[model samples]
Structure formats: C-alpha cells, structure tokens
Target: MGLRTIGGWLQEQHVQLHMGRWLLELDDARAEREFTSYDDVRGLAEGRFALYIGIALTLAYGVVDVLVLDELQLDVSLVRLAVVLLFACAVVVTGRAIWVGRHLQVSSVVLLTVVLLMLGTTLGRAADFPTEYLTTSCTVTLFGAIGLLRLRMHAVLVMAGVYSAVCLSLPGALQGVDALARNVAPTLGLAAIAVVIGFSLEKLRRTDYLRQREVEAEQARSDELLHNVLPAPIARRLRTEPGAIADSAPEVSVLFSDIVGFTPVSEALAPEELVQLLDTMFREFDELCEARGIEKIKTVGDAYMAVAGLPEPDPDHAASLAELALDMQRTLARLSPAWPSPIAMRIGIASGPVVAGVIGRRRFTYDLWGDTVNTASRMESHGRPHRIQVSAATHALLESRYTFSDPQVVDVKGKGPMTTYFLLGSNL
Candidate 1:
C-alpha cells in the first residue's frame, strides 16, 4: 500500500534491491528542472520558435508556388505535377519539424535544414528561364539562411555563405539589376543575425550545464551524509514520509563504556596528545562496531554509548552486546602499552524496552530516553575496571549463550541495591 510498508514486507522476506543505482539518473532529472544557463534557455526557446516559423514558411511557400504558376497561365504538365508532389513532401517535412519542437533536440534543427534545402532545390529547378530562376532563388536563399540559423553558428554561417554565393552569381546568369541588389543587403543582414543568435545560444547551453552540475554535486553530497549518519531505511523514510521520527518499539540492548581514570589521564597529558590518543582508540572502536553491526550512538567526555537493536531491530541484541563488550575489553588491553597511562575500561550492558528517538531541534542525536538508559549508565558507573557488568534483564537474555559469574548485590544510587554479573565468555 505504502512505500515503507512495502519495504518492510520486502525486508521481512529478505529481498535486496539496488535502489541506490538509480540515484544518479534521478539527480539528472532534477537538474533538468532548474535553469543553469541563460544561453541554454535561449537556445532551446529559439530553436522551438524557429521550428514553428519553418512550418509557417513551408505553408506560405506552397501556396505562393501554386498561385504564381496558376497566374502565369503555365501549361500543366508532368513536370508541374512533379513540383506539386515536391510541395506535398515539403508539407510533410514541415509537420515533422513542428513535432520535433517539443523535444528541442539539435538533430531536429538539422532535419528542418534538410527539408528547407530540398524545397529550395525543387523551386530552383521548377523556374522556366534565368529571370524567373533568380526571383525564386533569392526567396529560397532567405528562407534557407534563416532555417540554418536554428542549429549552430558554424552550420548557419556555412549555409548562409553558400546561399549568398549562389544568389550573387545568379544575377550574372540572368543579367538582371533588381536580382543582384536583392542578394547583397538581405544576405548580409540575415548572416549577422544568425551569428549573434548562434553564439548567444552556445553560451546559454554551457552556463546551464555548469549550474546543473553544481546542483547535482550538492545533492549527492547531502545524500552521502544522510546515509553515513542514519540507516538506509530510516533515512529514506525521513525523506519520503513527512514528520516521521525514529520510533522506539521493541526491547533493545544498550551498552556504555568509559575509561576509569580518563579525567586524571587528561590532566597529565598535553591537549593535543590526549586528543590523538582518543582519536586513535575511538577510530578503532568505530571499526569494531561496524564489523559487529552495532550502532555507536555518541561519546560524552570519557563515556561511549552504543546500541545493538536500533534503526532496525535484531532479536540477538543481548548476544551482540556481549560480543561487543568482550571485544572492547580485549581491544583496550592490547592498546594499553602504547598509551601514556595504562587505560582501563568498564563496560555496562542492559537489554530492555527503551524509548529511543532522534532528539533536539537543530543538531539532533539518536538517543534512548527511558529508565533502561538510566539503569545502563548506572551499571557502567558501578562496574569494575577491565570487566563487563550486565543487569539482571541482560543476564536473563544472554545466560543460555554466555557464561557469566554472579557479582554480589551492589548498591546502585537511585535504584537501590541491584543484582549484577560479570561476563566471562560465550558458550559457543
């Protein structure tokens, strides 16, 4: 019914799809919506307008050819019939040009040019003598020059130059004064307009391309950041579902770890040295969390918080937490010799129902906000250095898979005396 419900069903069935592969194509489509360059817009508009003009000119030329031939009382023959057939073909070509305007592709301009050239050639052949030929030639050359301008500047100039040469040479062939003068002014004027329009259109296209690229690059960066921070499903939901918050549903296991004497250690070392040490340790910790499919919430001073069932739920949350706690202890032990001071860590893990959600209005953080979070923090504070402490709830869930030693009932501040245990090793 809905995208999220469909996605949930797919996930439940263990189906995986390469949805991210379509991101680039979607981004390109979005980029097309914004105008990046003035030149591109102008080029697109001009080309479309020129196509419509070509259609109108084609119709006008067809009507004028028939009327002029009829007014002259020209003998109707097979040759005249052929000219009519050519005019019918030109009409079809013009209809195609009108259809192509919707796409505004450069190839459409090329097609229109071909059509105009064919019409011009047919008209030239149909004229009786050199005088009639010169008149038809001048009119055809003007239309051809304008049509060629719709494509590119170089193409337009080339077509205009060839047409101009033919028109100038026509007067000599016909020995007419009016035909010679008609060739010069109109040809030069049309050539200037074509050059200006072509260059302007090219500039617009380049500007539009650059702007679109910028928008696409920005959007890609944002998507990458979102993926890095939130789980794929959560991120996608946040984007598509309005006012969706990270929901806390079933029981989840939360773990917190802190160096026993981090504050004193910080006092002894320089600021930069302390930062370097923390950076190295946290970087490794992050890697381990990722390897174990655990989510690192955040670090506050010396305390590091992580969760086992979040963004997505896992029934093996307690086992996962146990594995993480053991790994953390081993990792800290290995790094002790390299540190300025012997670093000892205490880990507290608890599995229970917690209200977890992204908190804050501006700089938000995904955090658990329930008595379960409080109990976990207390467990960490009460834990012995170099040992993992588990609450009764966690112990119950993990007792079957893990061997834990019963620790004496400890006086936990607000919660009073609570039973705790030390995680030894996994049963398997």
Candidate 2:
C-alpha cells in the first residue's frame, strides 16, 4: 500500500495514531494501554545494544587520534579517553542494574552525550580545527550513533538542535561571519534528513507490532472454536498433526436415543417454534452429557447419539454411558417446550470393541463405527419409549450396580435373536 493509505489507517478508529511533539503516538486510550508493553520490549532490546555500540565506536575513534594526527595532541586524546570511560560505566549500570527498567531514558541520555563530546573535541583545538572538521564530525555522529539506535521523532529533533548549536558557535570561535555563511547549510541539512528517517522508522515498527498481535489474538479464537466442536485431545492432535485421526478402542460403550412421538408434535407446531423446541431440548442434553463425562456423537432429526470412552478411555465406560442414558430421560421429562405435552426419550446402550475416529475433510466430525454402535441403535429402536435398553454385554457389566428388568429374547435387525434387558434405575 501507499504511504497515504497507511497513514490514513493509522488514524482509523481501531488503532488511532496521533502526532506527538515530532513522532506518532497512540491517541486512543485503549491502543496506548495495549501498545505500552510492546514498546517497552523494543526499548529494552534496542537500548542494551545501542549503549555497547556507542562505547565501541568512541574507543575506536580514540585509536584513530593516536595514529592519524601529524602530532600526538595530548589534550584531544585525553578528551576521547574520558568519553570512552564514561560510556563504559553507563553500559554496566544500565545493562545489569535493576534500574535497567529505565532503558528508554538511558538511551536518550546516551545520544545527547555523543553530541556533547563531539562539541568538546572541536573546541579543544580551536585554531587547528578547520571549518571542514564540523562536516566530518557531524557526518560521523549522525551515521554511527543515531542510525544504530532507533529513536522516536522528538529524540531525533533534540539531537538536531544540539548539532545546530555546535555549528552556529564555530563562526564566533573563528571570529568571522564567513565561516557561518559558508558551512551552516550543509550541517543543518543533514539534521533535517535525520529527523525524517527517525520518524519513518518509529512509525514502521509500531505498525508491524500491531499486525503481529492481531494475528495472535485471531489464532486463539479459532483454537477455542475448534475445541468446542471436537474433543479437546482430538482438537489438539488435529492442530499439531493434521490428517485423518483414527483409533481402535477395544473397550467402550455407545448410547443412542430418540424423542418419542416427535413427529406428530413437530408437525403440530410452527417451523420456528419446532426449531426453538429442538434447540432448547438438545442444549439441556448437551450440558447433561458433559456433566456425566459422555461425548455426544451427533443428533439426527430428533435422535440423539453419544458415547463414553475411545477418545480418552474410561474402564467404567458401561457405567458412565448407563448413567448418561438415565439422565437423558430425566432431562427430557423436565424440559417444557412449545410442544403439546411433556417429552419422553428411549435410550439404548451397548458395550464392546469399536473403531472410533474423526470423519470428513472440511466439515469434520468425531464418531464411532462398529457392532457396538449398531447394537446400541437397534436396542433404542426395538426398545419401548420412556425406558433405557441395553445389550446382554452392557447388562452384564451394570446388573450389579444398577436395577434392570428381567431379560427377554428379542429379534434384532442385523443379528437375529438377541437377549436384552430394560434399565430401571441406579441401586444406590
């Protein structure tokens, strides 16, 4: 996007950026609150390094004084050495002390210090210092220190003012207006350019920070939605390793249930009313299933299906599924909807080995496929309303802990002639 477009967006309601003294700052209170921590991290990262770099460059330049000058000027050499020693002490204090919390403040002081030493060095050799010396000193100071550190607009302007003072004083020290008239333009010109670069860099960093945080917040919301749709463990697996999630659960229990007399009642109510009734009824079932540690498979028309075990195993799968079935009947009985009368449910549970996995590519779901699932459905269809029925396997596991009707031989759909029993209630 163009600069104009980005600037316009910076003023938008979501994250309003305003011009502060010389730099862009958050105008919106909420944006300022959010940006504070991000800006602190940037200061900490940049401040620690900028101090080290300034000290190294200052030390290197002192070596240049000893080698490059025609004669070793003791006063100029001593000045450079003092600046290096001072910078080293600042690094240790800011780098390791508890007051490193004041990184941004330390950084501003470091930049001003560079400008001060450069001025002092020029004044120390007033007669030998040619007008051209300001050009080299100003160039070195701007390029080495300011460019290495990321300073905001106001800080950049402060350095510009300090440099202008040193340049303006040169003409009087040399005792001539010709000195000011000749060299003033170029030195001031560099300071102006530094301001523009500094402002742009600060704006760019803030923009990148805002976008990165947006992406992280969006990812968190999506992961939460995915967890709600699938089991927590299954959702986590799919996120880390995406593919067909399959597992063979040898010991599990499955439950199938349907709203008895649903058709006649649904036909009697308006379409909107019918939908509202279903939503209300199922929401209750969903909450109850969660409380009983049951994983709801899906609801087909008025039929509700769920299972206990597989995704995560429970040795007491049969008992858990059985308790969920009993609660479904009680929950349905208590639900008062726009229907003609009270609702009742027929639930069936079967226990044995089953193959469980997530199905579908875009619109995915977690489900089970095996004889246990089929037997549970058959038990619900063949069993009576307002009652929970179970296969012989499930009944064997629960008869000791739960109350049940006398066993009866019934003709099953896929498998002929199977013995099943009706669940009455819990023993204790």
Candidate 3:
C-alpha cells in the first residue's frame, strides 16, 4: 500500500462517514417524531463513525510504512501474513458489533486483543535478533497496554500484559543481553513515554464524557421545568419560535379564581405551611385545568389564572371556562378540610381579547396583560365565596348553553361599575 492509496482510502472513509452522518440526521428526525426509543439508533450511528475513523487512521499509518519505507522488510513469512489478515478481519467484526446493539464491553475486548497481536507481530519482525526482539516487544507491549488502559478496554490491557512479559523474557530465552542492551533500553523508554501519553488521553476522555453528561442532564431538567410551567402546545410553540410573545389573541376566555379570605388564612399558618397548602391546592387546580383542556396563564398569590384560546385555540372558549370554574368550585369545596386553614374560593369567568405570553428576560413567567385579565381578577375579588362570577362578555357567549343569574351591576377597582352575572350551573 502506497501513500497515495492510503490517502485515497482515508478520503473515501471520510466521505462515507460524512454521508452516513447526513443520513443519520434524517433518521434521527424521523425517529424523534415516530419512535419511542431513539438512543439505540443514535448510538449505532455514533459507533459507526468512530469505528470508521479509527480504522481509516490506523490503516493509513500502515500504508505509509509500506509505501514510504521501501528498504524496510519484515522477516515473517506466509503464516505471519495470515495472522495479520485474521487480525484485520477481527477489527471489521468488532466494528460491526455496534449494529447488533449488544455489549460494547465484549466487542471492545475482542478488538483490543486483535490490535495488540497485530502490533506485537509487526514489532517482533523488525527486531534484528532474539534479544533485540524481546526488548522491542516488551517496550511496545508495555506502552500499548497503557494506551489500551487509557481506552478503557480490559482485553487490550490483558494482551499488553502478556506481550510485555514476553519482551522482558526474550533476552533470557535467547541467552544474549550484552549485545541487545542498547536496543532494549531505548524500547523500554519508548514504552514508558507511551504510558504517560495514554494516561493524559484517558483523563481527557473521562472529562469530556463528564461534561457531555452534565450538559444533557441540565437540558433534561430545563425541559421538565418548561413542561411543568406551560401547557404542551404552548411550550412547544415557545420553543419553536424565538422570542415568543403573545400578540392580540382574539376572543379568548379567561378564568380567575382566588381563595376568599386567603390573606387571613395564610397569616394563621407558618410561611412554609402556607406555601405547602398553596402548592397542594394549585397542583389540584392544574390537574383540573388540564383535564378540561385549559391553558394556565399564571398564578398570583392565592389566585389561579387560566385561558382558553391562543397557541391552538378552541372556538368554545367561553363554554370551557364556564365548565372549568364550576368544576373547580365543586372540587375545592370538597378539599376545604385538607387545608391547614379552612378557606372558600371565588372564581370569575370572562371572555375578551387579550395579549398573553412569557415576559421578562430573568425570572420570566407566562402571563396575560391587558384590561381583560385585571377585570377578571376584580370579578373574583368582588365575587361571593362558593360562586362563579362572569363578565357580561363571557355571559353573552355562554347564555345559550349555560344558565346565569340576572346581570348584577358591581363596582370594580379599575373598571368602575360593570355588569357581571353569576354562573348558576351548566344547562347541559
């Protein structure tokens, strides 16, 4: 094999690896959407690239030696050639192990052993005499063993150990040391150098793996947190769209529920206990919202806010909001006993156009802004406990499907006196 042939083979391998990576990206996209288990596919693709690159580089060196060093010749005969060929076959077999999706440990061991044997045989053939051969073999074996250890391949370590011992004992077997001392010393030194290099490489590899794992774990935690705070559809949209902010979302129904006399009740309990109680109540509220297919906007102190439009809107936003408020009132009534301090709830339902989205660069929250959210909050604040209040806008939308008490004119903080109605119950 000449340099040109080796370079061509390497270039071909690079092209193949690049093509495989490109195809793998397409496969990855499809797998992400359709397959539940994608790690296996990803692992196989990565392993294939690693093996392809490793073999190409290793063979390129061999090709360089064969082509550039014309004077260099191995004393080994047909048997040695057959052994080398067998070792090469082993490399290919081990490389294919990734496709089987089996134990990487077993495959690594087999491959490491073959590589060691090949290196040992090549070095042995280059030695001038038995003593020299022993020295050179020991040096190569020791260093190669260290490299294998760095690679974290147990099988390679075993091969290195055996090879090192053979090299050290070669002089004794040949019954000549004085003549081979010069070559032996140099071989031992080279082996020691290889061990140092292997140590450094292994440390770097471990550090890289640790960093990669940390990044992946952090990303998973962030994803989990995002899903916890936002509805699936909204979260997905926010992720796909950069710098997402809610524009003028049209005719979305908003629901606001606040615990009546929650301030006094919260004062009665410890801060931690108050938070715990709130968390329990809110978690339940979240489940109810999800069950009713409502997108939660945000929570303020003791109040729960939610919406039913934008980021995949539903036409029956008013009806859904009405139904959800009724369910929540009923559910909270049953859960009153679980709270450290007994409390009742006042829920307000309203339908109107409003802008809702994540705001703030730091400590951000998905919230609704505009008069609609404030008016809905005021309705809850002024509402009687155990009742659901509805703005005229919301009442009009649900008037056909839900029964409501006659319009009650109420004074609100920001929006003066407004006509609101009590949602009696669902007509359905």
Winning model by TM-score:
2
TM-score of each predicted structure versus truth:
0.66, 0.77, 0.64
- In candidate 1, position 110 carries an lDDT of 51
| Clash counts for the predictions, in order | 4, 0, 0
Candidate 2 global lDDT: 0.74
Question: Candidate 2 on 147-189: residue-level lDDT in tens?
Answer: 5555566667777776666665663434557665566777688
User: Taking the tens digit of each residue's C-alpha lDDT, what string does model 3 give over 1-428?
Assistant: 22222223233332111124111211233222221133334433454445554455444444544444454455433323544465456546645655444444344445545554544544455543445543443454345434442333233344445455455444343346753565455545554555456545544543444344445555666766887777666677777888766768878888889888887887788999888878887888888878877888788898888988755688998888888888887778787887766688899877888887777777667778777778888888889988899899988898988898988899988788999999999888
Each model's lDDT comes to 0.64, 0.74, 0.63
Tell me how many residue pairs clash in candidate 3: 0
Write down the TM-score for model 2.
0.77
In candidate 1, position 241 carries an lDDT of 79
Error of 3 at 263 (Å): 5.0
How far out, in Å, is residue 385 in model 1? 2.2
Q: How would you encode candidate 1's per-residue C-alpha lDDT over 316-407 as one tens digit per residue?
A: 98898899889888889888887778889999988888876665656656677777788888889999999899999999998888999966
RMSD of 2: 5.4
**Error in Å for residue 298 of model 1:** 1.7
